[model samples]
Every structure is written in structure tokens, then in C-alpha cells.
Target: MLYCKDCQLLCEQECPQCGSRSLRKPQANDPVLLGVFEPAIAFGVESILKDNHIPYEKFGNLGAAVTLYVGTAMETYRFFVPYGEYRKSVSLVEELTGPAEPSQEHE
Candidate 1:
């Protein structure tokens, strides 16, 4: 598999999205966004990644501070994985939390 470093896309032949031939094998340190999930689901995602032997990084959003005073219901966490393992990690996470929906941006 080849990865378009600029577009952060995984492809077999070439990056169809960016039409860039400057692709290379994915590396263990390349970070990719897996998804942003609720606290409950984030814990599950961490466990699944560990079981699958995938390295991951987790970060809390601004709402996380509120959780310290309020509760976890309002908190969200972002998950990232090595770009090399992103595809597999995504599949595993989807099984636990269903597929992620695309976000809409207002401009």
C-alpha cells in the first residue's frame, strides 16, 4: 500500500483524490486522525487498538475541562493512529461505534 503524505490518503496504485504520484510506504510515526468520539466510546477504542497491537494517541477537546466539573456526558475525545495502521484501526473502531459520519462545515 502507498500513502499520499500530503493528502493523508491510503491507496494501492496512486492517490486518486490528489492525483499525486509522490506516494510512499506508510510509516509507524505518521499520525492520522481516526475519529472524534464520546468519552465512553473513546475508552473502548483504546482497548481495541491495544488488543490489535496498533499504536494510538488520544487527546481531549476543550469540553474535556468541563467534564472535570460537570460530567463525561459533554466531553469528546480525539483519537489518532499511525498512518500505516489507520485503515485497520478504522475498521476496528467502526465495529465498536459504527461508521463515522462526515462533518459539514459552514462557511
Candidate 2:
């Protein structure tokens, strides 16, 4: 597999979505995305990461105002971990919730 620098995604040939040929091996510190999920799964993922002592970052699509009014039901979160810890994190998450789906939107 190759990493697409342009899209920040791991793909075989060109990027599966962008068709870009700019791909290379992923770097150790590159922030590899785990997945995008809703509140329930996102919180669980956070817990797993914390319990395992793996550093991670999460971002929400909606702003504070929107979330405050509409609540988190419509909110979606994106989780990322350094490439070095990616495999371990993926395995841990998969054991409990199966594989998390890759993100479709560009960051």
C-alpha cells in the first residue's frame, strides 16, 4: 500500500478517490486517520486510546453553536493517530467495534 500525500490517505495505486499519482510510503510521525464516527463510537474510541496510552486527536465537523442548538446527534467526528501507533490502535478498535470506515471528505 502507498500513502497519498495529497489526500493523506493510504491507497494501493493512485488515490482511490482523487486519482492522484502522488503517493509514497507513510512516514512515522504522519498523522494517520483512524476513522470518522458518531458520538457513541467516537467516545468509545477515545476511551480505548486513553486506556492504551496512545496519543490521538479528534475533530468535529459542526461548530460549538451548531452543536449547542442541534446537539451531537448530527455531529460527526474524525479521529487520527500518528503512523507509528496506527496499527496497534486499529487492532484495538477493530477488536471491539470492527474496522472503522475511512474518511471520504478531505481534511
Candidate 3:
């Protein structure tokens, strides 16, 4: 099984379809599938993934959600893995990036 060190998400030991353990990790060596977000965040994500040898790609410059929604934007980026590696990717991102701060309620 491939493990995402950043997020601690584990990919299945074997691929259901091919039964291969060739799970792809998002790293600088591989092409990352990026989503939209702020430049700082994007750079941070990339750096983390790169540092951990994860493959990824950056997309969008407008914003995070907009890139995911309209499929076009700037200032946002994301890293994508194969379907088999989805869970691991998410976990890694979460671990490396950490969870977002909770919103404070205003009285």
C-alpha cells in the first residue's frame, strides 16, 4: 500500500483493477493536478508535496472554488492522483496543509 506521509491517508495495498501497487503519489517528480486557491496557499501546497516527493499539478489563478466550478480561474491550484490514490491524496493534503481554522461566530 502507498502511504501519504503528509496526510497519513493510506492507499489500498493493491489496485482493484490491475492488482498493482503502482499507486502514484503527488510529488514534484510527477505532474500534479492542481485546483484554485491563493498564491501563498498554492505555493505552500506545492512545496509540501515536493518536499515529500508527491506528484501534483497547479491550476487556476482566480480562486479555489471558481477553478473547480467554472473549470477556469487563477490564484488557485490542486494536485490530483489516480482514482485509486484519491483517498491517500486527500489525506496527505490534509496532513501536510493541516485543517482550516474554525470560523468564529459573531454575536
Candidate 4:
């Protein structure tokens, strides 16, 4: 199962066909979207990707417009990215916003 702590949403435990939780995020190689901790961050990163012509999409509950607004306003979201693209996306984001500290890696 995949649990997005940032968005506080639980999705199907595994892929419908493969039953694997290793879903991949798109544009994992972008250099400006390490971790989307909040809806605002996701929106900002999405804009960056769009500007660069990098095809990407936000996953998890925060992707929903209503959920994003509620989560951001309430400050209770637990967002998460697809498992596969996490590393590459993080690296890209770090390159754009400076290297991430060890403690902030999971943030």
C-alpha cells in the first residue's frame, strides 16, 4: 500500500495489475521539484515543469483542486510522489534550490 504522509491519504496498496506499490512519478529527472511538502509547493513545481516543457503530473490526494485548497488551508496534508521518480525529482529540485541536507531528504 502507498501512504502519502504529506497528503494524509491512503491509496490502493498496490498496482492493480502487478500488485506492486512501486508506481513511478513522471519527470523524475527535473531539477526543481525535490519534494512537494504542500499544495503551494506542488503548484510551484508544476509551473516550473510546465515552463521547462517537462511533462509531469502531481499524484496523491493533493492533486485534486478541492483537496489542495482544504489541505493547504488546514495545513494537514501529507503529500507524496510516485516511488520511482522520487530520487530523480529530488535531485533536480535540489539543483535548483540548493542541496538538501541529510535530515531534509525525506521532507
Candidate 5:
């Protein structure tokens, strides 16, 4: 019998609960900002979202040219969720990263 990695539950063919193929993973183009977190908190963020069944997407090293756009270079990472699920994703983000802090308006 083959084992499924996701859902943390073994299955005979596929994960009936999550409907994921045995050994395959899920992917999506979710929108909204979950949070901009460093690598240290990435694991917690991913875990909470996965457990909560929230679809999200992560991006890193967004720069195409290294010297031209130093600001968008590696080290910075982000998480985004679908627009409709923004509220749910926000709650999960808070659970992992604590309450959201106030921000100043961009000029």
C-alpha cells in the first residue's frame, strides 16, 4: 500500500478527505496578503494554513535582475491568500505571527 504525504493520513489510493493524489501536493493562485514573514516563521505559517485548509501562495526572490533591483532580491518572502478568503487567512496569520501592527500610509 502507498502512503500519502499530505493530510497526514495513510490511504489506499488517494487522500479521500483532501482529495490529493497519493504523494502529490496541492497548488493554487490565492490572493490577499497573509503576511510578509522571514524564513524563520515560514514553517509555522505554512503549517497553520495547511491545517486550516486555507489556500495560499508564497513568493521569494522576486527580482529578475540582481543588481538592478536589490530591494527585491532574496531573503524577503511573502504569503498571499485568495481575495474571498482574506478574513480567514488573516486570522490564521495572526495566530502564527501575533496581532497585526498599525502601518503608516505610503506617500
Candidate 6:
């Protein structure tokens, strides 16, 4: 069995989706994609950045309105930060959601 490391799909011979016979595996130096998020999460991330002084840019994949309205859009979103600030930004976001309240049983 063959696999497409790029798209992480199991294939018979070649990647029918990406049409690549020799897909390269990702390396440590490769940039990390945080996530594709819904609007709420997108806005929340933006707010978190603003509050923590972390800079980011939105890479939206918003497709046709007709498709969105019909709930058939494949649109996704990505946010990026510079390589230098990536660690700091990730740390801040983690801290924000980290251990807000103790468990109710403990409380």
C-alpha cells in the first residue's frame, strides 16, 4: 500500500487527489498551520491576539455566498504569525484557555 504524505491519504499507486507520485514528507522547519476554524473561533483567536499583543493575519477561504447559504461550501480559514513570534503567540493562546476554573466536584 502506498500513501501520500503530503495529503495523508492512502492510495493504490499515486495520489488521485493531488496527482503526485513522489510527495515529500513535511519537515520540522515547515511552518505549522494552527487550524481551520469557524467564525466564532476565528474572531476569538483575533481577540486573543489583540489582548496578548500577538500579531496575526487572516487567510480566509470564504467561497461563494450561494454555496455558503446552501451549507455546501468547502471554505476554511487559516491564521499565521511570523516564525519568530509563533512560539510566543501559541503560548499566549494556550495560557488563555488553560485551567480557568477548578472542577465542580473540587469546588
- Per-candidate TM equals 0.65, 0.84, 0.39, 0.38, 0.54, 0.47
Best by lDDT: 2
Model 6, C-alpha of 81: deviation from truth (Å): 0.4
The whole-model C-alpha lDDT of candidate 6 against the native structure comes to: 0.55
Give the local distance difference test score of model 2: 0.83
Candidate 6 stretches with Cα past 4 Å from truth are: 1-32, 64-75, 96-107
| Best candidate (score: TM-score) | 2
For each candidate, the alpha-carbon lDDT, in order, equals: 0.76, 0.83, 0.48, 0.46, 0.59, 0.55
Write candidate 6's Cα lDDT for 50-102 as tens digits.
88776667666655674467663444556665445556766765565443232
Off by over 4 Å in 2: 99-107
Ordered from best to worst lDDT, the candidate numbers read 2, 1, 5, 6, 3, 4
RMSD of each: 5.3, 2.4, 10.8, 8.7, 13.4, 10.5
Candidate 3 — what's its lDDT? 0.48
Residue-level lDDT tens digits of model 3 in 1-107 = 35343333334564433455656554433322323345566666777667766555554545556657776434344445443444455566567567534431111
**Candidates ranked, most accurate by TM-score first:** 2, 1, 5, 6, 3, 4
Candidate 3's C-alpha runs over 4 A off are 1-35, 62-74, 100-107
Write the number of the candidate with greater lDDT, choosing between 3 and 5: 5
- The TM-score obtained by model 3 is 0.39
- Candidate 1's residue-wise lDDT over 12-101, tens digit each? 777766788888988877876677777788899999999999988887775556778888787778777888788799899889978767
Better lDDT candidate (1, 2): 2
Stretch of 10 with least lDDT, candidate 3: 27-36
Model 4 lDDT, residue 58, Cα: 51
